[model samples]
Target: MTVAGWETRKNVPLVGHQVLLQYRKGTSGAFVTPKKVRTDRDGWATATVKATADGAYRYDFAGTSLTRATTGSADFVDVK
Candidate 1:
């Protein structure tokens, strides 16, 4: 199945916000492929990942001239 995630601010959808999708493997590997995505009309950002080991995923919002930086929560994936 495909995995997806979203972003919001102060209960409002952050439409067109830039999000970076990242992943790290088994608590040892560095994060890779900071995929760029723009928030949709509903503040949603989605990424598709194929994993070969257990790892954690996170999304980062690099602060822009007008927007402060923030990070999304990390979720772990156990690949079989």
Candidate 2:
């Protein structure tokens, strides 16, 4: 599965934010350390992963107090 077109809250645009991708293996409730990436003007972000490390994954968009923005989360699959 591929995840695309993720965005931030519509109320606020141009808010500094970051996207984190985390995954676990085989129905496990555990999520590993996430990879961080910046977002675009459309609030869209992307995260790529291989099925080799397949599992339930969570997308976290957190605010940066330093940047004074909010955070959000989404879920998707990464086909290897």
Candidate 3:
């Protein structure tokens, strides 16, 4: 699967920063290991994740730069 998002603060994109992609199998399931990716000039970052099984999955982003930390969630993904 491919996870992608934009990093912004106060409506401004944060460039050259790192964002972590974290995933879990189900709503009540524990999250697996996370993947780290860097934001491009447009503040967009993406990570490729390999699903372990077919199920409902969720993902979120975590990032910090210059003492500022941010977290954002993406829409759920259904893997077959």
Candidate 4:
């Protein structure tokens, strides 16, 4: 699913908002090193991952503050 864009609710300009995505085997397992991403002009970004085999995959999207994450298993097979 595509994430909605975020708007800075602060009174000042929000610069350098960093984003990280972590994927792991399970909820109790260690979080894998996430690829660095930045919010677009509309504070939104997307990542397309392919599954090597049939298994469970979980992802987390974090920024300097709280942000939404994507989850579910639907057989990821391509980047596009």
Q: In candidate 1, which residue pairs clash?
A: none
Residue 52's lDDT in candidate 4: 50
Off by over 4 Å in 3: 1-12, 54-68
RMSD of each: 7.0, 7.7, 6.8, 6.9
Instruction: Estimate, for each residue in 1-80, the C-alpha lDDT of model 1 and write its tens digit.
Output: 11133353235566787788988878767787647888888878887767778988999877656457887778899987
Clashes of each: 0, 1, 0, 0
lDDT of each candidate versus the true structure: 0.74, 0.56, 0.57, 0.44
**Tens-digit lDDT track for model 4 on 1-80?**
23333564443332345545545543345556446556555555455555553334443444334435443332222322
Choose the strongest candidate by lDDT. 1
The global Cα lDDT (0 to 1) of model 2 is 0.56
**Residue 27's lDDT in candidate 3:** 59
In the range 1-80, model 2's lDDT, one tens digit per residue, is 11232474334443335667777776656777467766666566677666675467666655454343333443544557
Error (Å) of candidate 4 at residue 78 is: 14
Which pairs clash (backbone N, Cα, C closer than 3 Å) in model 2? 61-72
Error of 3 at 26 (Å): 1.6
